[model samples]
Target: MHGPLKGLFAWRFVVRAEDDVRHPDGRASTSLRQGVRHQDPEPIVANFILDTASPHTKVCPETLIALRYNGDMRPGQSATVIVQGVRTPCVVGRPGEANSIGAPFIVDGSLTFYFDHRLDAPVLYVDDENADLRCRAYR
Candidate 1:
């Protein structure tokens, strides 16, 4: 008795920092957290973990520090995040060292993750394309 296995496991997302972005014009963007925001220090690729329960996108504090992210966010702040070559101005902060790509980013980017569907791998799909594994723009 053999059949296709089925289960919903946490899917991981890997993305690279396209560049350091800051609040444009310093006009107090309501889209961002209600506080002072700053520009990114540097840009570098980072890995992420998908979590639907999370309300905002979270990056490792170490990476934020390395990138010179100087924003005021107890939860997070709006920043430009590049995923699978897709860019979106979303909230990101140094919640920890591990990148936590939460529902906010996924919903904003319209991404999908598949599992237990007779698939050959564990990965998130952007616009229904497996471009995550072969994105050159990020490189």
Candidate 2:
């Protein structure tokens, strides 16, 4: 039951990073880097996917900043996240890249918002563990 979400209010999810990575193709990976070239976590501003059936949410480097999570509301300034008490650095780029701002996706199962028109909506990442937070703006 998915269609154009026009004129409908947008929603957000603020969740903690899980140890699982659900790829766009419905494949689950253990690490986000997928063992390509593991690096430390860094500050980022990226968009995430809002899946109602999904048990988790994800973010890239760009959406993390644009959404103003982890104290990165200003431009030219880096953002960061703390995992296990260790602070790591991160940045946002494009999808499938090491540092993407947002990852495009189609979420079905439990998303509950109204749209007057169809939209490829952007879901910002919040500095939370659970992807259940909400935002008030549309970017």
Top candidate (lDDT): 1
Location of the lowest summed lDDT over 10 successive residues in candidate 2: 101-110
lDDT of 2 by residue, 1-139 (tens): 1355333323432322223344579996543333322443333323233333433223353455333343322433433333222222333334442222122122211122433335655433334433232221110
lDDT against the true structure, each candidate: 0.52, 0.33
lDDT per residue, candidate 1, 1-139, as tens digits? 1132233234434444434343567553322222323432234666565667978666655555544444543446555556555554446555654566778667655577665446655666576455454444434
Candidate 1, residue 135: lDDT: 45
| Model 1 stretches with alpha carbons more than 4 Å out | 1-43, 70-80, 88-97, 116-121, 128-139
Off by over 4 Å in 2: 1-9, 20-58, 62-107, 115-139
Overlapping backbone residue pairs in candidate 1 total: 4
RMSD of each: 8.6, 13.8
Find the candidate with the highest TM-score and give its number: 1
Instruction: Write down the lDDT that model 1 would get.
Output: 0.52
List of clashing residue pairs for candidate 1? 41-67, 60-96, 60-97, 61-96
